[model samples]
Target chain A: MGRKQVWEQGEVLASAMRLFRRRGYLGASLRDLEEATGMHPGSLYRAFSSKEGLFSAALDDYNERVVEGRVRAHLRDAEDPVAGIRSFFTSAFDTGGGPEPDPGCLLTNTAVESFSVPHVAPGVRRGLETIESGFADALTRAQAQRLLPEELDVEKSAAQLLALYQGLLVLVRSGTDAAKLHTITDGALALIRARNATAKQADEEEQR
Target chain B: MGRKQVWEQGEVLASAMRLFRRRGYLGASLRDLEEATGMHPGSLYRAFSSKEGLFSAALDDYNERVVEGRVRAHLRDAEDPVAGIRSFFTSAFDTGGGPEPDPGCLLTNTAVESFSVPHVAPGVRRGLETIESGFADALTRAQAQRLLPEELDVEKSAAQLLALYQGLLVLVRSGTDAAKLHTITDGALALIRARNATAKQADEEEQR
Candidate 1:
């Protein structure tokens, strides 16, 4: 055998992530992976073992780079926890005015595509949990600050927010225009605010 | 060539829809389609042209039967429009208490799987539009009857409801328990009711 060639794992993973997102897990072919990563079939196997192995690594990369990084930045940099939640919804549409070639979340995509490949389903589940927990933490903070309805079930609300977020991503991927998505996200924020407003009204009524 | 065999298009579409729902568009194979529909490869080709062709037919069937049928029934059978909207959401989780082998919406599945296959994306869009319009009609009626907030933008609220409903479906498909899905759905309905309650409090305050 010739001298074993070494490759940058991150570079391979980045390319794999893009390929998997664009073509999906089952739709992506070995030739597509080879071309995207500039690795021959033998090198691809030597480095990643199998397509599924490569997919798992790519999913990890997506979780860290896309989901985790975005969640932390949005939550940390916001004016407050409520604003942070609103910011989270708005930022999904800030993809710069360029035409979006691929617009869906890879984790959401994997959730739909994970039926056949059961091993990857757990990764999607974890990605979903990360999002749910992020929303849960924010909602909890909002409640403590009296910015959210005291009666809000943080766990259930967080799960609902996660689902709405995932659904918005699905609509975005399904070719809904940015303007319409912005309206939907705005409506969501209004609903959240209305919950708090209604609680305040109830308090005022009791005092009266 | 032997005489073309007559095949029931409805049966083929139903079988293809099930296979596509269980295994995603990309994950479902020609062999799986053949096995599900009980048709040989040549007959399958003769009937539907190609895999994409069959997927298109299956998508049409899903739109007609699952999506439109459910929306119409929920809206018509309810006591009123607002009740119709609530009914629309409540009906999604009524799976008769059996083990839910498939817990997600087929159109939502197609939406995620529509990235590479641009042709099928329109069908997902139509499904979403039908849902949004259904919610909008109900909300409009609710506003006229003073059951919803006057300032509510029916269009945006409808889209938001669509996203929430779609999100709920995604959660269901992701192995969330049926009871949990029910709670999440209940939370959504409460949010909708709270919108009007807050408005009622504001009116009472004005009167006071």
Candidate 2:
């Protein structure tokens, strides 16, 4: 209602997201939300239609502020697809490498918590699928330009990249050394690179 | 606590594990715990101590029964380390894969929750780390036996495996297709195998 109330509402949602990311939808509560956001039940309810509503806002914030802006940008920023993927992963590891790491990605977190309740599961589902599609589309374009392997299944390859990102984030959050993550990603990206190069050789030979 | 109450404790904890695994700690409530486990707060507390106490027990149950007993057994039952890792991944996917999936690993879910709250954080940390260590150790030994490969860092390699498992389970819970999960796992595992073989071959040739 008041200006402070609006700011508090945003603050409440942020706290809720952090708590939700830390615990999950079923694990968090109105009380926890209140404590974190500094809002009482009536105020919390007035701002958020329900607990689920708060969670939905938190997830939206996570995707918009972090996943699209950070993760995807990290992937696409390199001069090429291969370099882009590598940069994305390096950032993924280093970003979480500090003493404090936000558990890899909140999007990955959403994939886990959206199932047991009728809350914002769809939003999370779409978020996961949407990112995978973006990467897949990139890979497809790369393949057409001979940047990726012809053998790469557009959707499956996308999922593999998505899986790698998701899995690597978990490791980072779990406090793995950056060197180890580098090795893991190096090995993975190498495989993708090899596949791409091999496909190119075959295509060149066929054209000749 | 009465004998009947003590007897019900295990069931209550079991219910908690299933619910916690499915919904995570913050998402599920005392009322949800009561409804799921069919116990009153007084009785539940009398048996387990508190909500955090109950969670601690549930995590233990997950280790002893779900992970150690079931997952480990399946891994060992496989013909080789490659298959063993596959078994572990498949099991993670099995629980997570379906038309509707449960998105959380009980241990990963605990880690997410415990990070924000210091209350039961220690136990949560210990349990999840134990599982990660278990998978890595098993994979390392498999590599030592030449079932995995020489280039793979046992710790790093194992983290990769665990990361993929956690990632896929999260996606599955987020409404990822069961079939696509199969693709992600297959692609990931193949690269792991390829890395191992290529590194081993190079090392073997160097020995010659």
Candidate 3:
């Protein structure tokens, strides 16, 4: 593709991703996609083959840009990996103060919407596994830093964090208050903190 | 309505509930509802006014029958409320060894699907709130029984459990393995267990 065509294609995929995240798979009609992407039906089908193909592309874009970006920012690059995980959870909610309700994570929305579009199941699973693995990596680092107890099952806790992440997204999409979600996030992180040897040492030092 | 008519209506709602749970809001078309309920479109409209109306009623049925039933079975009536909460989480998965994939909880499904069907938002919130409150009630009882530390925040922990519950359902629908889900559930309950004075005391007694 030419340079302009490549840029346009990226823009179209981004638009499609927003629509899918907001309306879900079945909820976003072909006509809706056309409108959102500013592309004609003939051009859309010619480009992406079918609505499912377009959706899969959009989901791929989401996993690469959104999911991976968050993982890198909060888990891999952050100084404190556990703190990064907490930031990762809190980051799902929009802090922009926009009037639009939170549309939730595209991976989570697709996972729930996969009941209708089973073809997207593998993509949804891939995105979720990415987050799960990110958590595992972060927890392992946290354990090495004495931020977590040595006995903590990093794999299982990572899986739990994945579930908790998805669950918070569900609440966000369901119009849960941000304050409430914050409290839940804090409580969840505290569960991890309670298992932190460093945190226990700090407590002991303070008592002394 | 006559007794027979009432019985038939209950049956139809159950069928509709299952269809919605399986297919989500927009995924379950009018024809699908007709086939599921064995009611013609005109009759369905006459009975429930519109698809949205029918969906509202079905959600109400779910909250009453499925949500409330689970709460009573695993939370209210169980001898140990903490164990009851654990059972409530596990109960979301199908243990029957059926070939059919888990349909997940209707409440979580509807919450995710509510982006398209905003009318069902209240019912979804109500169902989630019921579970959160159920968790709170159980935690309070556990604390009263000295099963939990007096300093544990019941409300915040309940909300965290609510998020965890919804997240697990998302994973379940997304086709995560049951064994993985069980481990996540156990880890979550252990967080609560870590806050259990009774459990700690029992550990101490055993060690002694």
True contacts kept of 3: 0.64
Question: Residues A1-208, candidate 2, lDDT per residue (tens digit)?
Answer: 6455455545665677777776666667788888888878887777778887777888887777666765457455434666566666677666544665564466766665555556677777667766777676567667767976587656666777777777676656555667667665664464454342232432442231
Winner by TM-score: 3
Candidate 2 vs candidate 3: which has greater TM-score? 3
What is the lDDT, from 0 to 100, of the residue B171 in candidate 3? 91
Model 2, residue B50: C-alpha shift (Å): 1.1
- CA error at residue A120 for candidate 2, angstroms: 1.7
lDDT of 2 by residue, B91-127 (tens): 7667533664453577666554555444655555565
In order, the Cα lDDT scores of the candidates are 0.74, 0.64, 0.79
Q: What is the TM-score of chain A in candidate 3?
A: 0.87
Off by over 4 Å in 2: A1-51, A96-104, A115-117, A141-148, A177-179, A190-208, B1-9, B95-104, B116-149, B196-208
True contacts kept of each: 0.53, 0.46, 0.64
Deviation of model 2 at B54, angstroms: 1.1
Per-residue CA lDDT of candidate 1, range A1-208, in tens?
A: 9776677889988988888887788878999999998889988887788999999989988998888877776654444777787668767766767685764678878887778667888888888888888887887788888978787667766767787788787787777887677666654555555453233443442241
Model 3 alpha-carbon miss at residue B70, Å? 0.4
Compared with the true structure, what per-residue lDDT tens digits does model 3 show for residues B1-208? 6434422778999999888888888888999998888998877887899999999999999899989888888887777887788778877885678786676678888888787788888899999999988888888998888977787777777888898889988998888998887766764575564443232332332231
DockQ of 2: 0.28
**Quick one: ranking by lDDT, best first?**
3, 1, 2
Interface RMSD of each: 6.5, 7.0, 8.6
Choose the strongest candidate by lDDT.
3
Order the numbered candidates by TM-score, best leading: 3, 1, 2
